[model samples]
Target: MKISPSELISVLAQFNPWWRGGHIAGLPAWKRAAWHELNQWVTQPPVHRAVLLSGARQVGKTTLLLQCIEDLLQQGVPAANILYVTFDHPMLKLGGIDAVLAAWREREPRAEGIEYLFLDEAQFIRDWGTWVKHQIDFVKDRRIVFTGSATPLLEADQESGVGRWHAIRITTLSFYEYLHIKQLALPELPPLRSLRHLFDWTAPDFYRVTELAAPYTGHFHEYLVRGGFPQTAQIESVAQAQRLLREDIIDKVLKRDMTALFGVRRILDLEHTFLYLCMHDGGLLDMTDLCSNLQVKRPTAQHFIELLEATHLIYRLPPFGYGKDVLRARYKVYLADAAISSAVLLKGKNILDDPTALGVATETAVFRHLFARYYAQQVRFTYWRGKQEREVDVVAEVGGQIVPFEVKYRTQHTGVRELKGLMELCQQKNISRGYVVTKALDDFGLLAGTPEGINIMRLPAPLLCYWMGEAELHGVVE
Candidate 1:
């Protein structure tokens, strides 16, 4: 169903006669702090053909696009010039693309000007990327932005000669972005060399945690458990938050979005498998063992895992393969958001109390939280392991350098024994600095460098800023 450019505007005009619906459509005010990517996107000179945004579930793709659409329409692009389609609604039978153009033509039967096209959950239309390419070639005057979490919509554009597509990957709100929403951190700040270090896991030991007890520790702890997905931030009741994310989010990913994208059957088995994953949320993969548990062939189990990964509901972090990379070690798997892990179980404290399940959960939580914040630029985060019996929890490389860090439950000290092992690992890998980030401090902020240069820091899980890399301090440091 191909919609002519004129028809797209008319259909959209019904939804927003004055280009005012998205902002005034009884929608929640966009809450996350300035997404660093979008901040860079809107200002940077546009290069790729179409601006494409993709990400995990509930990362606010639809919300952000609506916000951008409202602004562009108000800026005076002809309503018809802007083409908006969503595979979720406007069913393919009713009008789909062709119907959209009919509506646009009805609205402004005879008008011609610069046009914009915006789409939501775009994977519904068959071959939407190729369809989009056809439309793009036909209408040289339109600017398009499409949002979808499915790998199809995300990957299709890349496959179909996507030379003109500008890609954006949205992710759940970060701890820093959450703080921004609560109005906890100021929008701008003076040049502070210490602030940047405080944000990284390998933060210099300059700040402390007791400094935050007066008004913030409890708040931060709650964030640690629930994560900063948009709905979690708005819902005050813990139980309500859990229910919403499970039915509305996780279910949608497994049933609606993923099924449509991957064309999967045996969804119930997949559901069971996912629940098993929730139970072992951050555990490493063992196909033979998982096959016995799921009563499926190893290939089937592997297929299920990869399918979960394809739609972003889950991710498998490959073990830090030493350069020899013998047989590429098994990966540790985790849900993309911690909120899911927290929601799937009734015992909130289980993650901390049960060491086996909890360690992986805690590690998974930190990876998602930190990766969600800076996976794009100025950061190259990877896990580490070697043939030797040592491992560093998180290893990040920035500006051609490596920073290794270990996560420990005790905050009262750096747990030197744990770090002593990591220090050896770091030296072996030629990575610098072994950091122990913990909950043992009595201050509201970070701890700077220890005298020996192995940056040690005590940090409460949720509130510490994530100014990662030197973006937080442009020229003062890097």
Candidate 2:
């Protein structure tokens, strides 16, 4: 059945509402939650030659891209001027970039500044970079934005989009966006702790604002135990939610993504390894132990972990290499998102036994929130494990200087001495600040340093998460 180009256009024309896009895209409406980022992308003209958006399964990449298309159309671009295609749809893959343009040719050739092509699940297209480049060669004035869950991770064909893509890695909603989904106003994060020490300085209005958020604690707990995947928030039954998280997101990543992208064959073993990592998501992982438990060779475990990482399912920390004393095999492992761990490892009251698991989930959520804000700038963040045994939960570059952070679930505490070794490393590197973020305190409780001007500020965790969402990781640098 050789299809003519006109036939192809007609087939695509049936999905024409998708071409109307945004409100017209005949799917779920764009979640109001993602407006901030979409607005940022929309308001700013394309800086990179093309924008590449990535995220976990069904994180609204298509809807967001459609809204982005609406923004383009509103800017005076006409419908025929734009090409829309599903480069990859898990259910039935169709319409690669070239095929999209080919179908469009049946209608008419692109008129200047009129044609914009959006390729959803772009990585599925064979030689996609070449296809788009071919378009760019002829249509010198054009726009091409791609949407995919698995970030191509700097691996694109040389034919078209080299040094051209500004990567926008979409993620599950942060607490900030979640609030927006509920139409709540929590634009700023409060002080870290609710300590009485700061009460004397607070005004009555401040207390009222703090009181307004009392309900969030319950939802926040639910978010921690169940996970932060968007659909997880919609499902009323926690059990059903967890099932979707495991079957749909987790397995989809392992089976479809890992195998399709990385050629992974021992997928069951990889699933087992992932379960092991989820159960031990926050523990200090020694890679050799993983090999022993999974009954695989050490290198096999390492390779599996690398694949897990490449697909954005797992994250590993280097033993903060400041001293010659740390073991190469002792880096800690964290699942990329807390919900992934919560989807599998958390059940009923069992989550409370290791209540710190909530903190782990929160930390992973925070890391992901912050990671997206910094990833494009080449900021490498990892954990710190000093030779002398002190540790920090997260580390990142601030104004080209490294900063150490410690995350705590403590409700009535101020602690940072534990990150002493990491702070020393910060001082050695002339880093700006050492921070201990927690839930208990409303104000930053300064930690006394080792008399060498090694500053430690026990600050609020929610503030950091909020700031990251606004792309303000650079805001608190010093």
The clash numbers for all candidates, in the given order, read: 33, 9
Evaluate all candidate structures by whole-model CA lDDT and list the values in order: 0.60, 0.64
Query: TM-score, each model?
Result: 0.82, 0.82
Best by lDDT: 2
Please list all clashing residue pairs in model 2, or write none if there are none: 81-115, 192-441, 192-460, 193-440, 193-441, 193-442, 194-440, 194-441, 194-442
Q: For candidate 1, lDDT tens digit of each residue in 1-478?
A: 6656454555565555444333336455543333344434433425536666777677787777666656666666555455556657654324566566567556655347656566777666666777777766776665666767546665666766466565666666665556555656433322235424555532233332344233543544556566657777667777777778788888888887657778788888888788878877766677777778888887777888887887777877665545547245777677877667767766564455565544455566567655544554557666666545566677667666676656664435554554555666665766544455555444323334333445444444433334431232132233
Candidate 2 runs further than 4 Å off: 1-7, 18-48, 89-96, 107-112, 149-153, 156-161, 184-213, 321-330, 346-353, 416-432, 441-444, 448-452, 470-478
